[model samples]
Target chain A: MSAPAPKALLFDVFGTLTDWRGGVARAVAAAFAARGAAVDAHAFADAWRGEYQPAMERVRSGARPYAQLDELHRENLDRTLARMGFEGLFDEDERDALARAWERLPPWPDAPGALERLRAIALTAACSNGSVGLMARLARHAGLRWDCILGADLARDYKPRAGVYLAACAALRLRPEETAMVACHDHDLAAARAAGLRAAWIARPLEHGPGRPAPEPEQEWDWIARDLHDLADQLGAPRP
Target chain B: MSAPAPKALLFDVFGTLTDWRGGVARAVAAAFAARGAAVDAHAFADAWRGEYQPAMERVRSGARPYAQLDELHRENLDRTLARMGFEGLFDEDERDALARAWERLPPWPDAPGALERLRAIALTAACSNGSVGLMARLARHAGLRWDCILGADLARDYKPRAGVYLAACAALRLRPEETAMVACHDHDLAAARAAGLRAAWIARPLEHGPGRPAPEPEQEWDWIARDLHDLADQLGAPRP
Candidate 1:
């Protein structure tokens, strides 16, 4: 049976819309070079991102109350840098600038055009773990047009939690059945489905890095497409 | 002395960016006409809006907990229609369509161009009391390009309250000093200033109706201009 059309499309921004891994690595490398330090930037980026879930887990597990992704990002960056023996290498201003790297992520090749197309037919928004400020700045930098910013900060909970998906639907005044969660990760789509939102999976082979195994659709989704362009086509958004 | 440059420009949508009175009046008149009811449409529009503040006041005064503007607007519409001796004149679907007239408000003459220009230099968003869904639909219908939606629903409080203004600022991760509240109403600007945000007053003499006294600047706002276009020029946004 065909799934119903969505009134709104909630997007996972980091891996799906923007190349966060590549962008973060590049920014960290520049920051390190400026401070006269040589470091494995790619490894540093991965390590920092690797800390993402565990940090959010603290909040999810109630070990810590909700803190914005920006705050968690900075903390993760500090710990990652410390483990790499680069602790205190950058001062407060430098750290602030580095923490904002997420705001300057580059959009994937198909993201901007596809998003513009989809937005013409349906309400589109960022439904990610990023804070509202982080998502807004990233959208500004990357030209990702969103009707509204809906993120972990707004829900006061991280993704994979029911609150994040439900909050995005609530903010749009849409039922979960009338909203689709589009993401690259299987876990995200699974959680969205569990929360009653339709799921559309888009594969990003290089999301982790080159030579890594490309993500395949492991489970059925409402719609699975190769990329956002394909997803837009499935949704019947006019081609640009 | 010149005020600091604003990092973000938050707008009051109903009267400031849109001709709500005119739009609502026209829509209501059409609904009445369709029902073969000879009602004074303009007066109906005014009376409907007249209940706006008092309904919000109940929420603001702790007499009622937070309710979305959509809910409040519907309640007010029902009371107004009943008082006009047209109780149950329309079915649920008809009432819903009429209520959605708020979502189709037309933008003022200079609003689109001025907002486009200003957005080039600063983050721009709707900071009205409208719910996110309402603002998003209005923006789509009116072709108002907002970077993100912000308002009462996010704050769970109505405007003129500290929480409403502060919530927008907090969502954008901006200090009140770095954000400007742009509105046609003196009371809105005054409330914004009291909450530490810079305020810009745009004169909309016809906001209530033609030939009605235009509001003059009652207090020293950060900037006072004839309209959004003039405000954009003052802020040095390149004329489009």
Candidate 2:
């Protein structure tokens, strides 16, 4: 059966709306090259992102008290650099720029246009693990027109935690059932669905890296589409 | 001396961006007429708004938890109706439609264009006491292109409270010095300045009612302008 129409669409940003892996890898290569460092940029990007969950888990598990994604990303970069034996290669300015790469990731091919269409029909916001500021900067940098920025900082917790999903809904004054969570990752949708929000999966075959298997939905979602455009069509938003 | 340049322009919506007094009066008149009641529409509008601060004070004083402005407005409407000797005249749906009139308040003549100009130069958001959902709907309804919805709901408190100003800045990841609070009210700017945000006062002489004296700045603010257009000009935002 078709799910009831949602009044809002809350999106997962990193892998869903934008190609963070590719964008981060490109940014890393440029930053390192400027510092005369030789590194596998893609590998570096992967290593940095790989720490994302564990870093957030520190807060989620109550070991940390809700640091923003930006701070965690910076710390992760420091640890990753140390492990890669490139410690102290770049100065503080260089390190800061590298960490900010997350804010400048390019949107997926269909994201900008699809978001415009979807926004015309219902409220659209970033419901990600990113901090509110990170989301705002990313939206501005990537031309993603979010109705509002909602995420970890607002909830003071990370994803898969009920607070994140419920906080986004609360920020919009919407009921969980009145909102839909859109993501490429099954785990995100699972958590959203568990929190009583409708879920839609968008396939991003290469979100992780080339040769990575496309995500398979762990459960039946309210809708599944090839990209944001397809999802917009499914949501009955008129194409411009 | 001129103030430091602001990276974001946070706006007060009710009277600064929209003519709430006029809109509310019109809505109230229509609703009462539908119920075959003759009431002083303008007086009723003023009285309804008069309760706004007191209602919010309940939350601020910890006597009540934060409630959405929509709920407060409804309660205020009922109280105002009863005081006007028209209690039980309108049903719940009618009361709801009247309360939602705030969502449909028309933008001031220069608001849409001036905001477009200002937005191109810096981040722009509705930093009002309105709930996130109410602000989002009002933006959509009135064609206010906010970068993000921020304010009361996010802060979980009302304006003139330090938390509200600081919360909006925190959401955008901006320092108080990097943001400017633009409002027509002296009290709001005073509170903003107290919270360390730069303040810009825009004159809305008719905000309260016709022939009402325009608010004179009680203290020196960073910038004082005739309207949003003048503010945009002072801020070096290019006119389209």
Candidate 3:
């Protein structure tokens, strides 16, 4: 807490600001229901989310050229559907809509208000792996305002990469030290720290869904909090 | 107005959303006054702006590699001061602060509200030659909220370049035909049209100050209005 506040906070959107699992599952369930099919939407959502890292890895390793999250998500959705034995259940347009489910992900209960308070103290931007268009749609959907969108598209690289972190800071005209990377994942924070950025851990116990063991911090971050509201409080953000 | 409304509107920041002339002049006057010097701040602001295109052209024509607006603005400020016979009038730190005067450009009277209204109907973003950092700070200063920041730094090129327009649309996941370039300058609109985007002209009679002839439409554009409010009304944005 004694460390000076960062001039800006670059946030990891998926598990940090949003309840991606729950939101995607709900959308998946509705999509299936519309087709008179009853599938375990949570399992499907998990399967789709499972493909995320490897998809990004393909680009990160130079195995594939950079692709937007939208494209990756769509391809992953198709793969997930095929893996689940529902390959032909949805047509191209339906598949596209289902992929866009990521855009409608809901904010965690504390996210919107905490972000508002945090913005009063520092510039807040999404530094997710999601593309700018995806982030923009999601921000509108969830009522979470960002000063600007910065991530995969802008960086042409995904999270955990030094280039991604450095690119976001450079775009903001801030040195890594002047910006803090806030995320619910240890690996993201670890990579950010390695890239010379300050790190703040925001615990999201329900990020992977209920009954799964929650993640615990593996190392000291510049700031550690139970949730975003706690982080806002710790940062001395003004109350509404 | 026969064409479909664009899914996103890319704005030209310098003269479109904000009054760079008056704002920079005010800041220049304040900075000089602090040093007990009286000068024609407006002329100074004009000279600084006049250097803009030629400086950008250096990068555009590959005479210089890409540099953010901040760097270009700082260089221009120095050259302008030197040309005006005020070289060494300020220290480096002072010069840097004065260069940042661009970030505090005042919004046109109808800009902030019109932008809010337009946002209700479509995605809105800054597509100026300004760097993402400059646009972000300027938006905060002017109370103009953009869904995302796009332009020079993101595209690695300045506007009037086809890549700049196409890059902005690409970042939004929008086709050029699905987005509109909104600006006060005919040349910008002409470039945007040549790059396959629709165009809207918002006239700023006093953008260069009174006594200067207001720029008229040199050719047909998708939409034309005296100000942003008229543009919003023509777009059928809901009244607040």
Candidate 4:
């Protein structure tokens, strides 16, 4: 805040600010219940997400055709549903609806407050893997107030790529010093930092509902907060 | 129409949508006149743009460190101005103002009509090498209405790169098939096609102001128009 101030704030979506897991589980639960199946969809939700990284890596490394999260999510869900003894449990329409269920995830308790705080201090934008259209619908569905959205679909490369980070900088017409990345995941922060962006952390303890494993933050950060609300408090931003 | 509809339209900024050359020339003309200088700024404007690709490519290929278009513009302007005998005619403050002249770029005459039409048909977003912050400033400066902005700073790579386009698609939650790239340049559309996006050609014959080279479409496109007004006409979308 002294010399080179941040002109914008880039946020990580998913668990940091939204309850994607809970949303997925709820959608799956309803889908199964309507189908008169007793499948444990909560477990299915966790398992499907568990397979996410590997599936994306396949596309990332060119092990498979260029595939999107929507397609990858569908493929994994289909295989997982069959293994869970829910064969023919749903049709194409149901499957498509479930795939888009991630778009309807609920925002975390502090998301609104944090976004307001960030916006007050600087422009707030989303830098996520979700498509721009998906982000818009998600915003509408979850009532997120993002000034704009940036995702892998925009840069054609996933996070941790400097090009991805740089693309956001280009669009904002800001130098790397002018932007800060706020994310729950440390790896993303590390990438942003490596690209010369300042970093802030908003811890999301139950990103995967406690059972699923996620990488923990190891590096020291410019800022650390219990939640978006805490960060807002520290930043002296307006309360949502 | 049988396919999943595009939820958003991602537009190319520079020549395709906005007349960067004309705008920059006007900015140069105004800046020069404001400083009581009698130089032909229009020539410098043409020469300045000529250096854009090479400078960006230097970063893209690591031949040079990453520099924003603004920085690059200043660098090129200073060199070109000195060469053109733009001596003590302008001071540092005037020079800086001239450098930011890019920010005050005017949209092509067709921009308002086309954007209005696209807005009625789908959410409209700008995908350009201009930074997100730059685009935002330009939007306010030019009164261009965009749902959002995406660019190199937003994604890191330049136009021919897929990051921001993919990011735009992800942020919009729209598949490549569900979104189309709109631009006056063929290289931009070609890249969009390679990424599996549909394309719209919005031609601007006067972008180079008479003698400069312009691009030609190399691939089959979904639609082509002489200008934004024509593009809007084909879509049957009305101006706001």
lDDT of 2: 0.89
Q: Which residue pairs come into collision in candidate 3?
A: none
Residue B223 of candidate 3: its Cα lDDT?
96
Residue-wise C-alpha lDDT for candidate 4, range B1-240, written one tens digit per residue: 223336678888877767788888888888778877776667778888888888788877767765667777778888778778876677788788888877788888768666877777787888888766667667656767766776566556676777657766755666787788998778888888888788887767787788656656666678777777777677777757
Kindly give the stretch of ten consecutive residues in candidate 3 chain A with the minimal lDDT sum: A207-216
| Better by TM-score, candidate 2 or 1 | 1
Off by over 4 Å in 3: none
| Per-residue C-alpha lDDT of model 4 across residues A1-240, encoded as one tens digit per residue | 223436788888887889888899999999888887786777888888887778777766767765556777888888887887776888988998888888799899778766877777776788886666667667767767766776566566667777677777656666887888889988889989999998888778888677556445678777777888787677667765
The residue pairs that clash in candidate 1, if any, are none
RMSD of 2: 1.3
Sort order, TM-score high to low: 3, 1, 2, 4
DockQ of each: 0.77, 0.68, 0.85, 0.34
Docking class of 4: acceptable
DockQ of 4: 0.34
Off by over 4 Å in 1: none
Write model 3 residue lDDT over B135-189, tens digit each, in one string: 8899999999989999888889988999999988888899999999999999999
Q: Which candidate is the best by lDDT?
A: 3
lDDT of 2 at B199: 94
Candidate 2 regions off by >4 Å? none
RMSD of each: 1.2, 1.3, 0.8, 6.0
iRMSD for each candidate structure, in the order shown = 1.1, 1.5, 0.7, 3.0
By lDDT, is 1 or 3 better?
A: 3
TM-scores of all candidate predictions against the true structure: 0.98, 0.97, 0.99, 0.70
Candidate 2 per-residue lDDT over residues A1-240, each given as its tens digit: 277769999999999999999999999899888877789999999999989999999999999898888999999999999999999898888899889999999999899999999998899888888877788788889999978878887787999899999988987888999999999999999999999999999999989887877678778899999999999888888879
Candidate 1 vs candidate 4, TM-score winner:
1
